[model samples]
Target: MSSLEQANEVYNKYGAYELMKRGISEGLRHLSAPYENLQTEDQWVGAKYYGNFAGFHNNFGGNLAETKCRTASGNPPQIETTQESEELEAAMELRHNGYTKIGNIYDEDVIDEVVSRYNNIIENKEHTKSSHSNDPGDGNVYIRGIDSPQEEYFPEAEQLVTEKVKNILRNYYRSHIQIRNLRAYRTHHIPPELMESKEVYNNHWHCDGKTSDHIKLFVCLGETTEEDGPLHIMPKKYTREYAKRNASFDRETDGAPNNVVEEHGEPVKFTGVAGDVMLANTQTCLHRAGVPDEGRSRDLVQLYIAPSSEPLPENWIDSELEGADPNVWSRLLKY
Candidate 1:
C-alpha cells in the first residue's frame, strides 16, 4: 500500500491515543540527552513530527511532557538584576495568557517619524518587496524593505526594539532570543465584491505552524480603533477548548462558528493608539486580522522572534535581525 494509505489506516485504527504514546516516547528520549549534546537532525525530526504531535495532544488535552522538556532544555542561566515591576508583570501575563499589551511605550516623536516614512513609501510606490505581493494589494500590504532601508530614512523604527521589550521576550522564552524577521504592514478594508471569494490576509483564525516557542511583537504606528482593523485573539485556554471540540489544528479558514464562540469565550480585540506594543505567542494562540471598515486601514510593525543561545545585541534591529525565514527548530535545540 502507499504511504498515504498506510498512514490513514494507522490513523483510523489507533487515532490520537497512539499518536500521543509515540510523541511522548520521543519527547522522553529527547529529554535523555543534554541540550548541548543534542543532534540537529534528531531535533529536526522530533520537532517536525513528535513536537507537532505534542501540539495536537495539547489542543485536545494537556501534555506535561511538552512543558517539562521545554523548561529543562530551554531555561537560561539566571542573571542578576532587579527587573522593572511592570516588565515583570507583563512577562507573567504573557506566560499565563499567551499575550500582553503595553500602551504608549514609544514617544510621540518616534511614532510620527515611523508613520511619516510609511506614508512616503506608500505615496512614492517605492517598496518593491512584500509578503503577499511585490506591490501593495487591496487586502494587505506588508512592505518588506522599509526596515532595512539603504539610506536610513527613519531610525526611530528601531525604538520599537527597546531593552524592556527584549527583557519581556527573554523572560517569555526563558532563554536568549533573536529577531527572526521584522516588517511593516497595512491591512485595508476588503472590497465587498471580493469579500466572499477572496480571502482577506490572515482573516481566518489560525495558529502559526512554526515551533511552539515563536512569538511576535506588534507595534501600532497610528491610532487604531475598531474601524481600523485591529487584531482579535482568543485566550490560550479558550483556544485549546475550541480546538478540542472542533478538532482544529493550524488553520480554520471560516473562523469560529457561532456555536463554538458561544461555548468558548469571545476573542479579545487589540485596539489602541500609536506607540502601543503587543506581544503574542502566535504558535499557541488562535488569532486573526480584523477587516477594516470602508476607507479605513491599519498600519503596524511586526517583529518575529525565536529562541537563541546568544544574548541579543544592543543594535539587534539594525544589524542582527535575520531574514523572514530562519532555522527556528535548530535554534530551539541550542538552549
Candidate 2:
C-alpha cells in the first residue's frame, strides 16, 4: 500500500485527528528552525545575552545601565534579595520605560455605563442559566470592536499600541524575537464568577505562540486587586526554561502542529491597581488570568499589536483566539 494509504490504516487503528495534530506540529518545527530552542525547557535559551528573570520590567533588557534601578541609597537599587525578587524588579523597570499609564483611559461615567452594560449581559437570564450547562464556543458574545467608545477601544488603543510596539522591538534587539504575522485584537470581559475556581477560571496563559512578534497589553477597567484574580506572570528566567521544554518547535509529521506548553506547571500570579496595565511579551513570559472570588468580577480590555510587514496566518483571526476556550478574550498577537 502507498504511504498515504498505509498511514490512513494506522490512523484508522488509532485516531485520525490526533495523528494529524502531531504531524502539523512536526512540520512547523522544520519551517521555524531557530525558534526550535524556544520550544525547549531551557529558560536561558533566550537569556544568553539578557540575564535574570521574573517581575515587572524583565522583557526589556539586562546588564544594561538603563535597565537597572537605582537604590534609595544612591546605589543600584536591588528590589529584593531573592531570585524571584530580582526578576520582578527587572520586569517592573522595563514596564516603566515602555508603558505609560493614562488614568481614565476611559471617561468615568462612560466606563460606569459600559461596566453596567457588561454586568447586565452576564447577569441576563440566558447568560446566567447557560453558565451551568453550556460551553459557548466563544463565550456568549464576541465583539470585534466596541461601538460605544470607538476612540478608546480601537483608535486610541491603536495609538497607545505604538509605545508597546517600541517596547517589543527594543527587547527583541538583544534576543531572538520574531514578529508573528497577526493583527492586533481587542477583548473585553465582565464575568465575576470566572475568578472563583482554578479549574473554572481563566487558568491558561494564552499567547500568539505561532508568530515571533508578540506583545500584549491587559488594560483594566476597575480595581484589579487580588480579589479580581490578578494575573500571575512567570518571570522571563522561568519562561526561558519553559520555551526550551514546552514551546520548542518541532518538525511536522503529517498535518499536525507541535505541542506547546503543558498546562500542569505552576504559574506566577500578578496583582495590579485600577488603571494599572500589564505589558507582556507572550513568547517569553507565561501568564494566566486569576480567578475572581465570590461577588467579584474582572473587567479587562486587552489589546494586541502586530507589525505591517509580517505575514499572518491565513486564519489568523480565528487561530489567534485559540486560547479563548475558557476566556473569550484571552489571545495572542504580533507587531
Best model per TM-score: 1
Give the Å shift of residue 15 in candidate 1: 46
- The runs of at least 3 residues in candidate 1 whose Cα sits more than 4 Å from the true structure, single-residue gaps closed, are 1-84, 128-155, 248-253, 256-263, 323-335
lDDT of 2 at 48: 41
Expressed as tens digits, the lDDT of each residue in 1-335 for candidate 2 is: 88688668657765877456545644554564564344433324433432222211222322121222111113321223343443344345444333223333444554565555444444442222223212334464321223322322223233233333343333323222222222221223435343232223234543333222245566665576677666666555565554445333321211011124334345544455434455565545555555555566565656543333232233333332322111101111111
RMSD of each: 12.0, 15.0
Alpha-carbon TM-score of each model against the true structure: 0.68, 0.40
- Tens-place lDDT digits, model 1, residues 1-335: 98567557656766866555544544654564464243433333433443321243222222232343335546564634455577777888887888998777776777787788776775565753455532336445532345355224444566777778877776666667677677776777766666555454766576665556667898887789999979888777676556555542333333532324435578888898878889987766778777788888888778777666566666665553434322233233332
lDDT at residue 241 of model 1 (Cα atoms): 58
Model 2 TM-score (2 dp): 0.40
Instruction: Please give the CA lDDT of all the candidate structures.
Output: 0.61, 0.38
* Residue 335 lDDT (model 2): 18
